[model samples]
Target: MSRLYVILDVFADKALAGNPLAVVLDASGLDAAAMQRIAREFNLSETVFLLPPEDEDRKARVRIFTPQRELPFAGHPTVGAAALLGLMEAMAGKGREATFEIEEAVGAIACRTVASGKRAGRATFDLPRLPQPSGAAPDAAAVAAALGLAPGDVGFEGHAPSRFDAGNAFCFVPLAGLDALARAAADPGRWRTAFGGDLGAFLYTRETADPALAFRARMLSPGIGEDPATGSAAAAFAGAVMTFDRPADGEHLLRIGQGYEMGRPSVIELGLVVRDGALSAASIGGAAVVVAEGTLFLP
Candidate 1:
């Protein structure tokens, strides 16, 4: 048996508020089945297991797993995993930031780590920008019905429900008010059938309550049932709205609050810009505190 070191809590300045992740630093000799079993045992939104880099120039390879299945790309897992690997380097007396090439099912995701504190700190990786906007958009009536609301509940007369992906798929449903956002509840089975599949859904609305706050989001994922704060889906949601909402130039920062429903309220900072009729140079960053650090004994 070997010891498996793991860390949890990402995207929150303080611990225990954001998405919880389980990171396996050394995944050598663990077959796919074994990895899946471990993931099921941990039962987080996602679990990342590390593999040796194929090339010396590269960092480490990563495999992402959900309790039910494996995901090609996930935002929190990528961030948490990269930071964990960097902390490992810091532990070994390496410099503050250590870089790694995370080879996943999607592709090689280049990760860079920066020490944020006295402890081995958070690392970051800007995943390959693969935003897919399939024209198969969802209508407002159907979206409202799914959220147990009226057709008039969706925000803005023009904006329709849309699908966007930065790697993982998401449905950006903007509501008329925080009441509708908070009252959100959908039959899991019905939602799966209605939306096709749930990588992300139904971000809570806040500006309706306080105009200064652009939006408040409550994200629902069929994979984890619910995610406190979702970075990738949040990024996709921001991109989707720009096509319809059309914010003015120079307003680069979009503030979206998520996780209110889950009791672990989270905030995601999205810096975005659209250029030449296309979204480009979108940067998503948030604070993550190490809530728990422990080792797993693989017997």
Candidate 2:
């Protein structure tokens, strides 16, 4: 059994700034139960398991898990997995840079590797651009009650609460100020009851702190207990906002800064194009760095 495990910092240009994830290579021998146990042992936001790719064009077969459950796709896990693969290839005497794809639960994705003394893999996946968004201005009363804010305090001229997805789901809510967002606390019961499952919530607070960045978002899943950063939700959010807002002309490239409150302080860059009142494409890519490499031994 291969005992190599790699940890990566995703969405941050430098190590230690972004979300840290564990990637276990050669996980073919581990069962589903063992995978969950391994994820729990890591106790990070998420952990990725990589097996030999089913297709030659693909790089690896990826399975992502939180301590609670397995996920079809996730952001940091995707980046983390690719970084691990690139490092593995280099150590095996491969060349400097490479391009590969990972066959994940979401499907095959393109991953490009660049060499900067160390292997850093950057992967971009085509998230199913939902033609129509699931959005309706939630009754102001219910929305305000849920957020513990007055009806007038919550709003957006171009957007409303919506559910968007690449591989995971995001219930997007926009708020007035970071203070309002910081004060917003969710009861665990409300999550399963309102969301129908323990899934993703993309909550954004308009930031006066930095006008250039646009906003700060806090993604929460009571199911996982805590997540420093979330990549899947970030993509879903960029897609949702673009789909719902059909403008005459122009593009919205949103910079989402999250994890500050948690002290990790991740910065995510996302863009979506809208034209003739329709959504076109969603692009989310970020930098990653490998922080540590070690072994996890199981008997």
Candidate 3:
């Protein structure tokens, strides 16, 4: 048997930048084990399998997987899949813009996609779940040690270590500046002590490589190493932003810079809607470029 798949660079307008995702089209026959194996074969940050929607009203059912495990929800995959689907529709002479729903392990995600001719597109999805504190994070000193930074480089202003989940969880760590962020690296020996057993650490700084961006970030994990762009982490970080920044009751837009150090610079657009000083809604948006398409053979 064979499957159709497309490789895309999510959060990037160009090829070979941002977080690369492999999207398997019409993955109805494959089981979870097979999906996992295929994900490992692709060996990208994440791979998504598109199946027929259980609810006919939805556009598709999306299953996201890392090299090691399946994820309930993932940001880049969702964005990339939506963009690709939109491009397919456009090429079929349907339309350039589309609004649809995609079912994931977490729930139904509402997506809006704008196709750019044949090669690239932008997608935005409303978060099915709001960000919530998952658990207590390790102290700043321990986190600093795990990231190979001094204790003093751990936080900035009112930010400290915290855990949040918007389907996927991450330990959000705020660094003092870009200098500390640049120096930070995950030390395997100390990683578990700081972020616990499964949570990856999302290190961020107010200083960005691009001054136009609101923040600079890096995602490091024992399993995945460094991710060029992390949409789920950006989604979860909304909780930390609300707690610390406390934006007035209105819609706010933030641009995050990531992957510069890895030479695949990327940008993530996060929109937060606040009401009465509380986060009411949030969305993640980014551009994805289709880089390659191929057939995958399977037994």
Q: Which residues of candidate 3, in runs, are more than 4 Å off?
A: none
Q: Which model scores highest in TM-score? A: 3
Residues 1-299, candidate 2: write the lDDT tens digits.
54888888887767777899888877997888999999999988788998888996678899998887898878778866765677667767796566788887767777666544564655444443342444443454455555556666566665556676677766777777787777666667555555555555677866648776766887766655445667788877765566544444566667788877777877776766666666676656666778888998787
C-alpha local distance difference test of each model = 0.72, 0.70, 0.92
In model 2, pairs of residues that clash are 259-265
* Residue-level lDDT for 134 in candidate 2: 44
Name the lDDT value of residue 154 in candidate 2.
61
lDDT of 1: 0.72
The sequence of per-residue lDDT tens digits that candidate 1 reaches over residues 1-299 is: 76465766777666767788888878899998888998998888788898887766777888888887788877788777777777767778897777767777777777777767644356556546746784477766767777777777786546667888877778878777777787877766667655766646855454545453467888875555677878788667766667786766543766677786788866666666667655665656555556666777777
What would the per-residue lDDT of candidate 3 be over residues 31-58, giving only the tens digit for each residue? 9999999999999989999999999999
Off by over 4 Å in 1: 97-100, 197-199, 204-214, 247-251
- Top-down lDDT ranking: 3, 1, 2
